[model samples]
Target: MADSLGIRVFFIKGPASVLQGLRQAKLSADVDVFVDPARLDELLQALRERGWHDRPVDPDSRTFPKHSVTVHHSEWPCCIDVHFRFPGMEKPPRVCFESLWVNTETIALAGQQMRIPARELGVLFLALHALREPLLPACRQELDYLGELARREGLSEGLLGLAGTTDALAAVRPFLEDLLPKTTSFVWPEASVEWRNRVASHEPGSARVLAILHATWRVKPRMLWGALFPPPEVFLGTNIYADMSMAGRLRQHRARWARFLRAMPRLVRDLRGLKSSGD
Candidate 1:
């Protein structure tokens, strides 16, 4: 369907694409794909027609605009994360897709043509992963893969340059330096206080907080209000607190109200944290 719509799709940020031929890397369960944002509506409609519908998970609620729409098929074990922007970015970069498309390299996978990020961009992507979760064991493994790729492709300088462009060089440099020379038993080290502080400042939680503030106070006040108190149909359509029968719908409404009430304390705490952070 994306081909028919002329929407260029690229596999990104998953074991299938990122670790395709890398034997040592641990495989991930889901596939991540980036599509041109201009054709997002068409792509979404096409997906729905094929029985792939959105599943609003925890991350979707925490991060508003930056969240990817996860779609699933009952028969398929793996899910697809449809992204319009890079994950963890607060806002969409102006030329992200354009540049990525121009730099993309096509490869045949499972007897079908597919696009994946070129070496430089792929390394930059790995660096971004480190920024997102530097402490994870999986991230350390990813860094190992990245280090090998950089050495094999002579992409050290090019990757560093790309990181610099994203203002991520400071956060990503140490990982690359430490991981590149080692081949076994990778020992993860604690990030410096300064680096930790920098990562904290760029947290998506903070971004979500700012989004809520902007929606409620600065602009689009109605957006927040509407989200908090949307019509029943919106819930039904999204399969949130949904019920097929009239009696079930009435019960679901009451249950939803109770759930919201129980969740109020946590919501208040999150809001307070946002205010205290001065975001």
Candidate 2:
């Protein structure tokens, strides 16, 4: 549908992982499309006209910055995540889109053709996605898999260059440090504060806290309110609250605060270490 509108879009993440032979299709996976930011508003309006509407999002989700807007049709089994900027691609949205589009490749999907990032960029996409939650066991497993794949593909230089282009060299520095140890230490960029904080602190519900700290004055109040009293959708549905009872939710919230407090000393120390190294 987007393609027919002359919108430049390509499927990524789950769908691309399947096509790139990196992973098998999962039953619950949705269609994740990266759209040109310039046309995002137009595509969104078109989607609404075609019976696709923005899905309900929890107040907790609004606390943090959003990279994509989700829309779904009642007739469809899965939602379509329309992304304007992929996380970890800290560079400008259009720049990232153009960089990936340069190496775009076509593959057959359910008879019709579809666009996806090239093998190298596809692997990069997965790597960036994993680094967003580096502490998660599942994400760690995926990173391990991709590391081996990167080695097999001899993607050392290509990955490094793409990381630089996408402003991700700092975030993926640790991953590349071992994978491409042969590369000079001087070339690795310093990690950003956002990357360090997110990767270092993985406790559930901590993001809401960080969101308030990170928000500018203009948005801080909203972030604070959302953090304190997120909707039931967040309290009940999120991993932070395994049980939805009031007591259970309070316990989880306390646990999250404890974890965040514990992680802070290490996280701050790590950031200081990065800065000391000339970050």
The local distance difference test score of each candidate is 0.61, 0.75
**Model 2 lDDT on a 0 to 1 scale:** 0.75
Residues 37-72 of candidate 1 have per-residue lDDT tens digits of 777778888999999977655332322334357788
115-167, model 2: which lDDT tens digit per residue? 88888888888888888887788889888988888888798789888888889
Q: Give the C-alpha miss distance for residue 189 in model 2, angstroms.
A: 3.0
Ten consecutive residues with minimal summed lDDT in candidate 1?
A: 58-67
Pairs that clash in candidate 2: none
Candidates' TM-scores? 0.61, 0.79
Candidate 1, position 205, lDDT: 32
On a 0 to 100 scale, what is the lDDT of residue 264 in model 2? 73
Off by over 4 Å in 2: 58-63, 215-222, 231-279
